[model samples]
Target: MMLLIKNAEVYAPEYVGRKDVLVCGEKIECIADEIDRLPVACHILNGKGLKLVPGLIDQHVHVTGGGGEGGFHTRTPELQLSELISSGITTVVGLLGTDGTTRSVENLYAKTAALNEEGVTAYMLTGAYGYPSPTITGAADKDVIFIESVLGMKLAISDHRSPHVTIEELIQIASKIRVAGMLSRKPGILVLHMGDARSGLTPVIEAIERSSVPIRTFRPTHVNRNADLLEAGYEFVGKGGYIDFTCGMEGQPSPGECIVEARRRGLAKELMTVSSDGHGSWSNYAQDGTLLEIGVSKVDSMLQELQKMVKELSVPLEEALLYFTSNVAEAMDIGNRKGHIREGADADMILLDADLNLDTVIAKGQVMMEDKRIKKFGTYEHSK
Candidate 1:
C-alpha cells in the first residue's frame, strides 16, 4: 500500500527538516514541505514528533547460524525476523564464518531468500573461512556474476582457525572477485575475516603489494578486535580501502570510542562501516588459544552503538547514521537504491520516539514493526 507520513522530522541520513513524505508502491514518491491529498488509496501516519530516518543496513550477519566453534552442540540458532526488525535493521548481508564445513554457502543463500520474503532486503557473500571457499556455482566469480543474491566472497585470514593459505591463493580468489565484480557491475568485495593473530593486518598488506587489485576490492571486518588492529584499520582506510568494525565486542572500547578515535586521527570515516556480526559466535580465548567462553551476538548492538555515537560521543546524527547506512550500501554497490531517503529510493525507514527509541520500522513500504512490537516474522518465527 502507498503511505503518506506527515510532520516527520526527516533525516534522510542528512537532516531534511520536518516535511511530508509520499510513498508510491515500494518506492518513495516524493518529499516536500507539504504533500497534497494523493489520488489513490494510501495509509496515513501522523509523525508530528517522530524522527524518520532511513532504515539501518547491517553489513555483517550470520543469518543461517554462524557458530560451531566449540563443537556441534554449541552452534548458534538461525536468526529470527523479529530480531532484525525490532532492532531497526532493514537490510543484512549474511555469510558463513569458521564452520563452513557443516554449513554451506547454500544455507546462507536459502536464509537470504527467507529474510527477503519476510519483509527485509537481504543479500550474502558466497564463500567462507577456507582456501578455495565454497560457492553456489562452484566458483566465487561464477556465483557473483550469475546469482542474483550472491554479492562477493568471504574468507578467514590472519586467524589460527583459518586454512593459513599462501599469499598466492589469496591473490587468486581476490582476482576472481575483482573480475567478477567488473563483469557483473557489482562491488565484488573480498570480505576478509580478521582473527586475533599477532600479525594483525600484514596479510592484507601483502595481498595488496603482491598484486594490482584495487584496494577498494577488499573489505576487512573485525578491525577493532584490538588496539593494534584498529590502528592498522585506520591506515588501511587512509590508503583508500574499506574496513568494518564489529559491534558488541567484550572488554574493549565501544564502537563509539573507535569512531571518535578515527576522527581524532584524521582517518577517512567515509571508508569505514559498522557491523554487528549478529548471530555469530564470539569466543573468549586464553593466550594458549583455548576457548574460555563462548557467546552469541545480538543485532541490537548495532542500533545501540549508533545511539551511543550521537548521544554519548556527540556525533551528528547524519554522520553517525551514514556509517551504518550509506557507507555500507556504497560498499555493496547498492548505495543509491538502499541507504538514503530520496525520491525513487526504497521506502525503508524507521520512526523513532522523542527519546530516540525505535517506534516503527518500514521496509520497502511494508510495516515490519510499530510501537515496539513485531508486525512481521520469518516463516518459522510465526509457525511451529
Candidate 2:
C-alpha cells in the first residue's frame, strides 16, 4: 500500500513545517515539503493543516490486561488490538504488574507476539512484581538474550507491595540483565515499577553509585505518582538516568506538572519519557494486606497527557510529543523502526487536528483509524 499525507505540520522531534510524508509497504519512503506528483494508485490523505507526529509508544502497559487483586475472577482480560490503535499507540512494551502469579510470562509473551502478528509492534519485559521473576527460559539473562520479543526486565521496586529486594540483590539482577542485553544487543534494562512507597528510590540511588553497573540500566516509572517520588526521579535524571512518568488515572498529580516541575528544577529533557500503563490495574492496597480499591488504566491517558502539555501548559508541541513517541522509542532501544518518521522506519504515525485531537492513526502502513473512528474494531464488536 502507498500513502501520501500532504500539507501536514510535521515534527519528527525537530520541526519541518507543512511537510509531506510518503509511506509504501510499511516503510516511510520519503519525507519533505511536498511531493508535487503522485504515481498510479496512490492513496492521498489531506492533512488539512493537522499535526503529524511519530506514533505514540507506550513502553509500559499490561497488553495481556493485568488485574487479579480482588480474586481469580477479577483478573483483567487480555487487551484487544483496537484498544491500542484507537488511542494512537503504535508500539507497546507489555509488562505484568502486581499479578505475576496468575498472569504468567508465557501469557505476556504470547500476547505480545499476538499483537505483532496482528500487525502492531509489541515487546515485553521478563520480570514482574516478584523477586525471582518468572521467565519463559527460567533465567532473566537468557530471556533478554535469547527471546526476541523480550527486551528487558521489570521489577516492582520500593513499593510496599513489592518483594523488596536488598541493594545487593538489586545490583545482582541489574548485572545479569546488563550482560545479557549486551550479548543480545537488546536494551537489557531494569524497568523499575515505582509505587507510593515512602522509602523512595534511595536503594536504586545507592546501588548505582556503588556498583559497576551504569545508570542507564535502570529505567524508573510512575515518578509522578507522588511529589517525593518525582523529586527522586529528577535527581536520578541529574545523575544521567532515564525516568518515565505514567499518564496515570485522573485526579493524581498531573503528568504536565511533573514535566514542568522537572524542567523548573533544571533536569535534562531527554532523561524523561511518558507511558500509559494501559489495561494495567491500579489499586490502593491497605496496610492490612488487602486491595482497598482498584481501577483499570485507560489507553486514552497517553493522548490526554499530550493534549494537556500542548494546550493547557503551552509547551511546544514538538517537545511534548517526544515523551510519548520518540523518547520512548529511544529508551527501549527501538528507535530505528518504531520512533521517528523517516525512510526505512515503520509507518507508525498519528494524524491530529489543530487542537491535537487524534484524527487518524496508522500502524505498520495500515490505516487502523480515520477521523477518530476506528477502522478496525475488536473481533466480537465487529461480529455484532
Candidate 3:
C-alpha cells in the first residue's frame, strides 16, 4: 500500500514546514517538497490546512487493564483498539500495575501481541509492582532476553502498595536488566512506579549512585505526583536520568506545567517525557492506608494535555510534541524507527486540523482513523 500526504505543515516533531510524505507499506518512503508523479493505486490525502506529526507513543499503558485498589470489581477493563486509534496513539507499551497476582505478565504479552496483530505497534514490560518480579519466562531478565515484545520490567517504590524492596534488591534487579538488555540489545530499563511516599526517588538515586549501572537504566514515572517528587525528579535528570510525568492525575501539576517548570529550572528537555497511564487506576488513599476512591485513567489524556500545552500554556507545537513523540521513542530505545516522520521511519503519524483536533491517524502505513472517525476496530469491538 502507498499513501501520499501532500502540502501539510509537518512537525517531524521538529517543524519541517510544509512538505509531502510518501509511505510505502509500513515505512515512510520519502519526504519531499514536491512530487508531481504518482504511483498507480496510490492513495493521496489533501493535507492543506492540516498539521502532520509523528503519531503519539504512549509508553505506560495498562493494556490488559490496571487497578484493583478498591476490589476486583473495580479493576478497569482491557484497552480497545478504537480507543487508541481515536486518541492518535500508534505505538503503545502495555504493562501490569498493582495487581500482578491476578493480572499475569502472560496476559500483558498476549494483549501486546494482539494489538500488533490488530494493526498498531505494541510492546510490554515484565513484572509489576511487587518484589521477585513476575515474568512469563520465570524470570524478569529471561523475559527481556527471550520475549520479543518484552522491553523492560516494572516495579514500584515509595508507595504503600509496593513491596518496599530494599536498595540491594533494587540494585540486583537493575543489574540483571542491564546485563540482559545488553545481550538482547533492548533498553532493559526498570520503569519505576514513583509513589507519593516521602522517600520519593531515594531508592532509585542510591541504586544508581552505589552501582555501576548507568543512570538511564532507571526510568522513574509520575514524578509530578507531588512537589517533592518533582523536585527529586529534577535532581535525577541532572544526573543524566530520564523522568516521565503522568497525565490526568488529579491534584497533581499538569504535565504542561511540569515541562515549563523543568525548562525554567534549566533541565534538558530530552530528559523529560509524558505518558497517559491509560487504563491504570487512580486512587486516593487515607492516612491510614485505606483506599478512599479509585477511577480508571483515560487514554486520551495525552492528546488533551498536548492541546493545553500548545494552546493554553503557549508552548510551541514542536516543543510540546516531544513529550508524546520523539522523547518517548528515545526513552524506550525505539527512536530509530518509531518516532519522527522522515524517510526510513515507521509510517505512524497523525494529522491535526487548524484547531489542533485529531483528524486522521495512520499506523504502520494503515489508515486506522480518518477525519476523526475510527476506520479500524479490534476483533471483538464491534461484534455483537
lDDT of each: 0.89, 0.86, 0.93
Candidate 3's residue-wise lDDT over 37-58, tens digit each?
7747788888999999999999
Alpha carbon lDDT at 362, candidate 2: 89
Model 2 per-residue lDDT at 2: 94
Full-model lDDT, candidate 2: 0.86
What clash count goes with each model?
0, 0, 0
In model 2, what lDDT does residue 381 have? 54
lDDT of each residue in 1-384, candidate 2, tens digit only: 999998888878667788889999899999988786775677888996788888889898898878788887777777888888878898988999888887889999998888887778999999899989989998989999989999999899888769999999999999999999999989889999987778888989889878999999999888888888878888889999999888874566777778888888888888799888888878876677677887788888989899999888888988998788888888878888888887889999999988788899989998888878888765555673
Model 2: worst 10 consecutive residues (lDDT sum): 375-384
Where's the lowest-lDDT run of ten residues in candidate 1? 375-384
List the candidate numbers ranked by TM-score, top first: 3, 1, 2
Better of 1 and 3 by TM-score: 3
RMSD of 2: 1.5
Q: TM-score for every candidate vs. truth?
A: 0.98, 0.96, 0.99
- Give candidate 2's total backbone clashes: 0
By TM-score, how accurate is candidate 3? 0.99
Worst 10 residues of 3 by lDDT: 34-43
RMSD of each: 1.0, 1.5, 0.8
